[model samples]
Target: MKANQKATILLIYTGGTIGMIKDADTGALKAFNFKKLIKGIPELKLLDCNIETVSFEKPIDSSNMQISDWQKTAEIIEKNYTNFDGFVVLHGSDTMSYSASALSFMFENLNKPIVFTGSQLPIGDLRTDAKENLITAIQIASLQEKGKPVIQEVSLYFEYKLYRGNRTTKISAEHFNAFTSPNFPELVESGVHLNVNNEVLLKENVSKKLKVNTNFDDNVFILKLFPGINKTILHTLLHTPNLKGVVLETYGSGNAPMENWFIDEIESAIKRGIHIINVTQCSGGTVLMGAYETSTRLKEIGLISGKNITTEAAITKLMYLLGQNVANSVFKTIFETSLRGEMND
Candidate 1:
């Protein structure tokens, strides 16, 4: 890694406040040409990297982000993976976490940075935080250690902090500091000097070639449990046509009512080959099934524990695993285990 060498970074604009500008007459925010972005922020030219920009023909808002978009994004990465040292994804703040999480699982044996970032206010706004986020994201992606990419996994960078992508959630709408990885620690912190927590970063396996999985089965749904939830509603949802999996957002420690009807519905669903995963509704914590009598039946009934996994990650993991056609016999075991460093053991 010669100091004179420059990392070649690819900036993929997928539509977000970071790439938005105010319409002169309409006064509404609209997507701008990412190719001309570096001109507005000349600071990007000063970075120790060679940057190239690409944009979605019709950039979509992150809220409108779907499986198809994930597949396209992955395809772009796969096609250009060899030519670029790292990738910076510009996505809307709203659903950035979900996209990031999905991409993490999509790229198997990834050995380069896939950094997602966005701003709360439009980049053209006077008070915007877009420039800092965008600049830092690129810098983080282009980082190298001993001539190799340092951040070799999907991640989200906002407010000067770099987080494991799947672990982040949009915690604020108006504030510049919008995303938070509640259950995970910051991978890097940017202050006067960029700080990389090398110990916590994902270890790269350079020996394996990158493999992309774009087959995402959308035959999944999330069921957030609540007090006095009617069995009829639960039954209806669990019986959704072609339903393959469900991310059950349960109470503390994955507990639920011990009523016979509730337990019966769960068992019935499981028996029918519908995967049920128990994830905590709390912002931060692991699901400790069977810790209480209320949760004992859930564990006994074979609900997979989503230990410290965010809802975004849980739902996407369910979709990814189902898409992979994991054997029904080993699905439970695999679901409980952390894939792509997405959850705690």
Candidate 2:
């Protein structure tokens, strides 16, 4: 990222709708051969940066995205960290938020742009939005100022907006604007010009080397509470073998049913060394643990408050923290803390 030096961008394609095209023989959708990617989109030659392409040996639908895939993605970035100026990750939109959030936690002290983007329609379709999304994502990743990358954290760009990857949630299935960052503001927006909200971006850190942590423990579950959530269901989830963490999707303001059994069950789980984090079911608000009488018991019984964190981020953060084997005494404090700008202060 030196002045007058052209940026080099690594495009990591991990499979998604954006990489699909209709097979000539059967007309069925299939992954586009990335080796021919440039041939298909010669427009890439027009960019000011040098672009290199890499693909997952076997591309997977985002619904099938797993912990191992996340590790692989992180490893890819780790392997090329020194050689590349920026990275653009092509991921399926279905579980893009989870993968993005996981990568944000996996890489500590990240100092380059890792822009994740995918299209709602296949690139072959005449009405596809894939071209614009891919084009703008690379543009954002290539942005530089004072001989340094402008974006230094993981982010998601869809439709026309760029958001902190961990702060995003897929909000629509049919529309082009499929993701939203409810609690945090967008980092960049695309239109007639690419407008970067510089103040909202994560400040760059140059002193520390990029550290990749792939030890994600999947011994966690999200227990979304609802009316008539019986004791049997609660017991089953709480007593699951090797259950290290639980992202409890509680009622408004992190409230739960004010019954003796509910309190006893939650307290028992906490005593058994189970980490339960209370996140609001609502999409756009912080969890106020002691704002109501019903939530007062949870706050007193040692549940961590996930202030305004999306469920996708909460679950992945739980896995990342658990895998770190953080001390039991400090688990609550650490869970509540804003790591990688996933939550507000």
Candidate 3:
């Protein structure tokens, strides 16, 4: 691969709806060969970008995606970092947000575009949108202006919109546009023309080098606070054996009951060195933990506010940081900061 070539794009097929095909005889979903992608979509020739694909030995749904899968994606990028101008990840919708969010954090100081795209329908079917999505994703990946990458961060390009991966969430199950990022603004809106929200996009460190950290420790749990919950239940959750982190979904603005049992359990978790991340249950607003009296007790403890970070981003960031074996103190401080443009910094 020549560095001076117009552009080189790497397509990483991690398995998902885009690769699904219904057998003519049995009508069952099966992974189809991506080699036929260009054959089916002849329009790819207009892209004018050098593209190559790498797929898993046996494609699995995103629900089956594991730490090993993330490790594989990171390895691909690492091996071809200098050879490719950008990357596009084909993933299933079920866990697309989670995986994209995790990659946003795992890849630090990224200079090239890492755009994740997949279709709601299979590529082989008639009236399928896979060709358009995949083709446009490649265009977005190789897009440039003034000899600099147009997008220099990890993002999700779906249904003509590009969003910061960590800020995005899968909000729709039946529509082609299945993702939403209400807290942060969309980076690119593809309508009559590709409209990019340049201010919201992240800038790369021209001097710093690319860094990839594939280690992801998923030893975490989520506890949603609801009314009529018993004290024993709260204790059981906070005292879970071998707990490393927790994503605590609280009421509006991260407010939670100041009841003695609730406060005690959270405090105990903090004392035990468990990283407790407080995020608002509402999809739009941030977690202002100390903004209300009801949440003062939680702030009195060491529970950290996730701010405008989405639940998907929170869990993935926790997994990535924990896997890095970072110091407890550093993890506590960095969790609230935007490391890879995953949160509003």
Candidate 4:
């Protein structure tokens, strides 16, 4: 990239509230034609960048987003990797965190920005926040130093903050601030001027070429523990046919019941080669297995600690790792280590 070259950005509209417009005929909400986006938001013409648009043939709501949708998004980025400087993914906010986390894992050695954003209100609304969010996300993606992109990893830009994709979780539905990064700080903040926290940004790996990994296994389940959970439920879930992994949502610091039946069921599952990950139910803390007496048995029985990882990241990472056909013996070690900064060391 030369200093004199203008940035080229790709806007991918995958059905969401942000892309909806009220139909004059039926007064119903419909997906906006992204090809005419500039006409709808003329402010885009003022930016010093070349913008291109693409849309899903049939837009899907975020709640209905599936693994195939993730693969399609990855394929889109891979297809245009060399042609575009950055990508702004307009997705529904309901499952944006999940999609963001999945994309973060799917791309390897990425050196360009893949920013996900959406709004609570439609862009056609007079008092909508969609305009600001959309414009700022593109601006953030267009930012560069020297001749390279400033953001070099998958991120989520919402309201007025930019957070690492895997670190974010949706915290609000009614408010404009719809996302939060519980275990990590934001990478950038929007205000009078865009303030980037360069210290937290992922350094670009220019030595490696970008690679996309679309393999994802959906044979994993999240087992959330609660008081009075009985043996039958535990046994039945663990005994599910062809189950590959389990994300055990334990109590604070990864603590679980110490009952004999509970220990027996968990130990039997592990012995049968089920990979169980211990993560805290708390939103803001790390899972410290063996930190207390209640968790010592779990550690001894070979539960992998999900250290400060959001549940969204944990499940997606599990699917990614499982799809890679990681060896059973080394799976625990690899999962405990951070492959894409999804968890603390």
Worst 10 residues of 3 by lDDT: 1-10
Residue 267, model 1: lDDT of 96
Give all candidates' CA lDDT scores: 0.92, 0.93, 0.85, 0.94
User: What's the lDDT for residue 173 in model 4?
Assistant: 94
Q: Supply candidate 2's per-residue lDDT for 62.
A: 97
Q: Model 2, 63-180: lDDT tens per residue? A: 9999999999999999999999999999999999999999999989999999999999998888999998998899899999999999999999999999999999999989999999
Candidate 2 vs 3: which has more lDDT: 2
- List, residue by residue over 131-150, the lDDT tens digit for candidate 1: 99999999999999888898
Query: In each prediction, how many residue pairs overlap at the backbone (N, C-alpha, C within less than 3 A)?
Result: 0, 0, 0, 0
Name every residue pair that clashes in candidate 1.
none
Q: TM-score per candidate, in order?
A: 0.98, 0.99, 0.95, 0.98
**lDDT ranking from best candidate downward:** 4, 2, 1, 3
> Which residue pairs of candidate 4 clash?
none
lDDT, candidate 4, at 40: 97
**TM-score of candidate 4 against the unseen true structure:** 0.98
lDDT of 4: 0.94
